[model samples]
Target chain A: MIVERKSVDLGELQLDSGETIPSATIAYESYGELNEARSNAILIQHAFSGDAHAAGVSKKDGATGWWENMIGPGKAFDTDKYFVFCSNVLGGCSGTTGPGSTNPATGKPYGLGFPFVTVADMIRLQKGLVEHLGIEKLLSVSGGSMGGMQALQWAASYPEMCASVIPIASTHRHSAQQIAFNEVGRQAIMADPDFEDGNYYDGPGPGRGLSVARMIGHITYMSDDSMREKFGRRRRQMSDESSLFEVESYLRHRGGQFVGRFDANSYIAITKAMDTFDLSLGHASLGDVFEPFDGRFLVISFTSDWLYPSYQSQEIVRALRGRVKDVAYVELPSSYGHDAFLVEAGEQTEIVRGFLASTFKKLTPVGAAR
Target chain B: MASAVDTAVRADFVPEVLGRGDYQIIGEIVADGSSVLDLGCGEGELLAWLEAQRNCKARGVEISPTKVQKAVSRGLSVYQSDIDEGLADYPDQTFDYVVLSQTLQETLKPRDVLHEMVRVGKNAIIAFPNFGHWSARFSLLTTGRAPKTKHLPYEWFDTPNVHFVTIPDFEELVRRDGLTVQKSFFLRGDRRITYRPSLLADSAVFLISK
Candidate 1:
């Protein structure tokens, strides 16, 4: 279906770092109609590099949303049954107020001047958008990777806002290795001469550095087995100088593609946000963080996902075991590692569809809707 | 695959009768409106049956990821867990019934697992193949090898039943553990066998409480 982008002025967002954005505009897209009772509303959070266009053909780029396969009329999100909404997060470059957005204070782009945004901050902005839509309690909040972190934050920070939660291929906290990988990407961007201290909007920008950073990030997204299956010891055809390995060529292509669509500063800000994402940051334990959540939970993980592995999802499940009454967890076997949630949509669809169907049934009993 | 669809259609008509194998009998035994925790609940067949037939709140713990996925797809709350690790997360007598159906023989420490199940639930329902059945004894005598019947189909080398116990053996363990057998059902296929169950029954189902 042809979906259009909608924007809402969130006024001023008091960020977690004691910084404030004078005016923040959140770009969002919606599918289906919100029922009269507004009980069928579902909020889908996007991943690290993902945008507000979660489903359907994007109006701006004419490309499909990242989760297009799973959010259609009869798909997992099931637009026919539920009103699904996805918003570009705070510090996201996609139509949202981010590093690229013009700063009202200096009339220049925020760029490096943008204060760090945490997963909690992103959820707060999302809450504003949900409130703007006039939805009191969301039927569910779901997402993968950074989006999954946002989903967890929503369940923890605003426990009563959503009736159910689905956090797929994600973790409650970033591991030391996760932080190190993000650090490498950030250093790559900073090392770029053309970065111009994040004021390269009028210039060529950190194209090479951002491309390199994306390449590094891309490797972590895929498993060794998937990479091997896709391109083993095979060599790519190149002119005269030297032959390129198939995997090397693939990484280059992915990195080049990423640089054209994404902003460098926003990547830095978002990754930093993800690094600081610990559900039990100030709490005594993970159980204490999830104590307030009284919703059905579906925690999914991929077998080959070493970045945010199945063990990480198990940690969340372990914490929620006796704490939450209704929690379902599945570690789907997939060759595609951390990117399995994106790549393995067909398998995910069945699990998500069943979960949403059951959760909806519990929320709205037979004849209760009338 | 068509059979699965047929089963789904059949479930809509009469859910209690739709369950396959021992699950059908287990579904009948579980009380209506009760809370059940099915340990080693492969693909949650029994839990799903319990939910549909008895309108019970059913949760499952299965070790296999593939089976867990299948169970979740059926809209059952199934967790991927090894029962041998214990059920410390669940408080004492949290559930009305904790079921260890046809999985006791496969557990590394059957006694420890049973203890956890009994500790967590008001009552425990256990079902396992009777290794001392007449057919198994006959097969062992004739073939001069480990018995392989409908209930115990696997060969000794490939068998998952690491600690196989007969009806008499299980009853002995139950008595030794200070658990009272509230009810018991011995089956030869779908038919209930009561007289000389240790030699006649292929599988045994028991409802025990401490």
Candidate 2:
């Protein structure tokens, strides 16, 4: 299916940091039809560097969306039965207001002038777009990695608007190690002389810095087993100053490809938001954040994901179970590590499809079998 | 390797429409619209039945990845967890019934699991194959080897059942622990056994409360 990106102009977004943007435009995409009752709508959040074009061939680039395998006519999200929506986050550069967007006051790119955005702010803006689309309640909200964080924030902030949540290969908060990794990515960007303090949009920009950051990111996304199986000790033996080890070359290629598509400023802004996320930051306990939210939870983790380990997902399950809340969890078997949630869509499809169907049945029980 | 032959001979113990007879008994024991938690709920077959027929809100804890997938695919709230590691997090009396059907003997710490079940639910329904049956004892006496019966069909090396208990042994534990036995049902194959249940019955189900 060929899909086009749509935008909604939500004027004036007063952020949680006491900062206000005069005008905010959210770019999004949706599949399937919203029923008369509007209960079949499901909002799928995007991970870091992901855009609103979650599924289908984009009209602009004609490239397939990131999660195209998982959301289609008969796929996991099941567009035939669900009106699935994906929106670019508040601090994203994919047609959403971000650091690359023009500043209304100065008539120039906001760059360093862009207000800090949190994961909370991203979902808060998404809430406005959801309401504008006339969806009173979502059957479920789901995503992987950073996208999972947004789904969790939605359930925490607006439990009344969601029936269930499926947070896949993610954690409720960033550990010290997670924060450390983000710091390395941020430092790489700032160290580049060409960065020019986020004001390099009109110049060559910090392409090398961003590429290094992405190379580090790609390492964390894979497992030791996957690396050995895919690249082994093979050498590319390239003539240029390019990488020699096949794995190194692969990372360089991926990083080089990513530098052209993503903004360095958005990378800094989003990673900081992810590093700062803590569900129990203000609450008395992790259980306290879920005191008012009485929705079912499906928390999934990958067996080899050392970055977001299974133990972290266990903490969320343990907290919910301590409060006697309904929660289900599964540690999927995968050698792909954190990338399993994206590439191993077949394993996730059955559970997500069932979870959504049950959530819908719970909300609208008409004609459902006893 | 010859376990398939044993399984075939014990076809009476095989699953029926609602799964095993123990599941049907569990379905009867569970109250309508009540909450239930099944420990070691393999693919959540019983819980799904309870949800569909009794309108119960059912959840489960299973360790097998494939089984957990099957359960979740059926829209059952089954968490992938080791039972020995779980039940500690669940609040007191959270479920009306905590079912441990046909999985008690396989646990590493059966006694601790039993106590945790009682702690987490108002009632616990336990089902286990009776190792004190006449057929098993006869096999042991005649063959002079590790006895293998239809209900307990495995060689010693491959058997998952670590701690086997009979009806008498279980009742003694319950009595020593000061737990009230609400009900008990003994069975041989698919039929109920009432005469000298410990000696004649191949399996037993007990409902206990503290």
Candidate 3:
């Protein structure tokens, strides 16, 4: 359960937009050991607002990793069998190069000056990290939401690098509805008086705007059923004169906690990247986007996840049908909405465990250790 | 419950280790190393069996989410969807065989689904309970009520087979649709019946192609 945060200097990175970052640093954490063949590596991509801390308890605080339940000695990722790698994304604030990171040229925080990073770019950078670990091929690449997007990009971009992929609660492209949601969040952050056009690194720094944005995001992460079950029309008494609705108080609390851990500039950079994510950007068809993939796939979606509905996952499955010989898809019934991938780990464990085991059996040499 | 007659013809098929069951017959009919798509593949037992025995690339579609979960847990590729709606997402003749086992009688539009199966696959394997069996005829004649037997176990109100078809009715429909029957099998409780199957057999399986 002991976890340590490590940083790697990726040197200068050329952005997809033709912009160049003078220096890039990727913060990552690893669990378990890589096999002699370096084939038992599983890359875990974190979702929007998530960091490198994926499993085990944090050393700084007594807190568990974001995907603590899904990755451990006996968990779905199975640390004992496969080496699990989780890294903070390129356009992330948590210990990675982002808007918060000081620009080498300016000798100050990058703020809005950070180059726009794409989902494909993130995978390219992650490829650097994987190569640094001496792994030529990986067992699987997996994640949910933005993390899932990165996994999809990995499959599309470097098909031979991984043996399998598990993209849960994710889509091949950002739908108009998804783009609109991210746009609203971005607007909320930009409109705040304290935002100061993303140059408030020296000041209090757009706390109210960022909090509002987080509140909007938190609502979309949950379903109507889950929200109703957690907090009905019940109200909380703040004082004898006034009271607040339970749901309102809950959103405010989540927003407050998010502000402390996240930076507003990084939120804009990351959400914008998610909005522009499309696997079929230059391809003729969605199937063409996945035609080069030579690995097994396990695509999962939640029934109540309106933000990224099951149909989106089905679309990916449809595209992959004849193209990939080994692809499995499941739409699990859950009231947890878009956040089900994180909250409903128990329901996902069996499917994930079976998929990894089967894919591993197929990929491993016959005489290799089990 | 396999009879002596069933054991005699079992040698005709390439030997495969399969448990004695109705689906095992369907599994045996499937060609080795051919891709398969099973409609209404409950819990993916047949698909998994095909993968292990025939070494075929198998996929399935089941309407129930619970069954899809079970199928996924067994490492089978299955999508949760209504088969009656058709396999529009799949390209033409993508699979070598499309198997609709036992669940065809419960479909709202069996003929349309069968047509879709033919369109998406080079061949279609269909299985359904024979409503014109002697036991069902005897029950209807004597009791003047809808037959309720081991194959048709549900009560009138709870029966999923809304449009049950007798063996003759299905044969006529197949002929009318211009589909050719490559092979046919009739069973009386796991015992292969070749003589007067419409009247004696309790279940019918057909391998058809357009």
Pick the DockQ winner. 2
Instruction: Give a tens-digit lDDT track for model 2, residues A253-364.
Output: 9999999899999999999899988888988888888878888899999999988998988898898888888788889999998999899999899988887777778788
In model 1, the runs with Cα more than 4 Å from the true position are A239-242, A368-370, B1-25
Q: Which one wins by TM-score: 1 or 3?
A: 3
lDDT of each: 0.88, 0.88, 0.87
Error of 1 at A212 (Å): 0.8
In candidate 2, stretches whose alpha carbon ends up further than 4 angstroms from where it belongs are: A237-243, A367-370, B1-15
TM-score of chain B of each: 0.87, 0.91, 0.89
DockQ of 1: 0.57
Candidate 1 docking class = medium
Where is the poorest 10-residue window by lDDT in model 2 chain A? Answer: A361-370
Q: Residues B92-206, candidate 2, lDDT per residue (tens digit)?
A: 8988999998899999999999999999999999999999999889999999988798877899999999998989999999999899999999887767778999999888999
lDDT of 3 at A266: 89
Error of 3 at A107 (Å): 0.3
lDDT-sorted candidate list, best first? 2, 1, 3
Tell me which residue pairs clash in candidate 2. none
Model-by-model DockQ, in order: 0.57, 0.67, 0.54
Best by TM-score: 2
